[model samples]
Target: MMHDIPDSGDQPHLPTTYASVAVIGAGSWGTAVAATFALAGVDTRLWGRDKDVCDGINRDGMNARYLPDVPLPKGLRAFDDMAAALSGVDAVAIVVPSRSIRAVARQVAQHAPAGADIAVLAKGIETETGLLMTQVAEEELEGHVVGCISGPTFASETALGYPTAATVAFPFSYADRLKPEASPAARMAISLSTETFRAYVSDDVVGVEIGGAVKNVIAIACGMMTGAGFAENTRAALITRGVDEMKALAEALGGRRETVTGLSGMGDLTLTCSSTTSRNMSLGLQLGQRIPRAECFDGRPVVVEGEMNARSVTDLARRLGVAMPICEAVRAILHDEADLGQTFAALWARPIEAEPNAMDLSFAHPASDKAIQKLAERIA
Candidate 1:
């Protein structure tokens, strides 16, 4: 019969270092992230602008608008009051769209504590600015230890407590100010990990951002092809080559190629591109069927980020001369009014050059590997 999450005295001792965390945005991903944090024994506050969604979570332990069927953790509470949701939290996770990250980060700066570490859970490039979500957060929340959390997490599955993993990357080092081995990102990774949700920490912030952003674009392309009646061979090729495109853009922006092979890159890319459940992929499917863009999202409440990200990502790639034919083609279809059939034809007819890059296709780094193993040991 209780509505809001019980007081601290009614809860068990928290497992993660962070005793409290606020997740802004009541959409699927945000709700999922907040739910898992609560299940992990953290005091999780979910902030939503929509009062109805907030009331649903507070009363029913579900976001009827975003995640209707799944029951959220008892330790999770939803708040319409942003300040109240943010008050006294040890960390914050901004789960808004990349386009809104700047504004939301500013609000967080105003409300969250001075020392709370922040992580961006959204995946996309700003259409107008071409800034990664993490960059936008860093610019808006200066002096905050900002990081990124991304991988192949589906909102429903992850929220339901299925096994999920993500790469948490923060470029700044805070060991001098925090615990001996605790970087802001390392702390974030630990705070986010649960029995079913594993966290991998990394410093390749740019790489992780690129992988997260571009994969959506690639997923759109795959959806287009699939909608056009293409089969497994083509889809598989797109995924494999899509990895190259993602890797190239990341390296052009000072991200490591190896990061492209990790959870945030290959892992997320595979799931989004292959699954019709993904909004980006599904949108492309509609477009390939010659449906109008306006009609695609007519009743959909969640934003399909790839639709906008295509423009900024294409522009950024061109500015840096990164060869991203697939992403560029996607932009053309979505923005330039290019016919889907012709675009697919052009992609197929393009000059076949020798495959570039050795395509190491492996993810390894001493620090990340060691830390992951240690986490497994602790959990086991």
Candidate 2:
């Protein structure tokens, strides 16, 4: 929680060969990336909220609370002092929860070097402003370049040195700063990638950010289906349609359509929806078992980013005039006290249209559209 920067003499020495990187937030994802940076030979320091997690990481080389039994890279260090963590780093990775991103960005703005590149690992739209993580960073870290890294990464798997791939989208507005001679983005890409973790670079920040945010909500819906004993057909339908919902929102927000089908979108959606280790999906499982939302989170400290973003993302889609039925259904369930039956009922009542860019129903028999409309009306 160190807010202010000290005198210039207090600056930490950064290695020239390996970029100096500070990963804010010692949660699962943050710790995993810190370990990856260390493995990549970067000077990495993980900033944690509590002292015990930091103490354990520093003393035992294990994030006992987040990634127990997994030995971290020897070079990775943890600190409770935020200023000490951020000082003189070439890149800062904001891996804190979505809600905390803005505040952490402000803190980073104060302490991190002005030329340092930032990579946000937290996924989700801000509930208050309905802004994506990158947008939120822009607000608090004005004059600083912000980017995002997202994909099908489960923190535990990555911490265990399992093979993983992610996409990093640096802002194009920083083109001058990203020149081959002064390429912080290239350095960031190099620092993030390891033998086991591959990082791909992209320029479509909106597409990458939206894909990661929306998939979590879809995963929650998928988890509910699994818990309710729904067949694989239901799961498949959700996953397929969920990508469309994601693409719709991303396209509406000035992002490339193809980006949604890439690593940050389809890849992430598939991994999250199918895994019980996902915190968002696990929350959905509890709800699917008929547990009340309040009861499910009674004393748990885990931040379910999907639950936090469900309504906000739905609102964003609404403002953008994009239809996202899957996200809408998730919002209803999480914020409206809606049951599974009600969610399905609402989904069934929606107008049936041909999948986006599929066979043109207008050229096909008019009867086909009429029949689909009739079925939708009947369901309604």
For every model shown, what is its TM-score relative to the native structure? Answer: 0.87, 0.87
Give the runs in model 2 whose Cα sits over 4 Å from its true position: 1-18, 173-182, 297-301, 357-380
Q: What would the per-residue lDDT of candidate 2 be over residues 218-289, giving only the tens digit for each residue?
A: 999988767666668978899999999998899889998799999999999999988778888888877776
* Cand. 2 TM to true fold: 0.87
Candidate lDDT (C-alpha), each:
0.83, 0.81
Model 2, position 323: C-alpha lDDT score: 77
Best by lDDT: 1
What is the alpha-carbon RMSD of candidate 2 to the true structure? 7.7
lDDT of 1 by residue, 1-380 (tens): 10222234774532236889999999999999998888878889999999988988888887888888999888899999999999999999999988789899989888988889899988888877778888888888888878899999999999888999999887754442233225666667767778999987778889999999999998998888777777788789889988999999999999999999999999999999888889999998877666777788675665788888899888999989888989988999889988676666566555545666564343334355444454333322
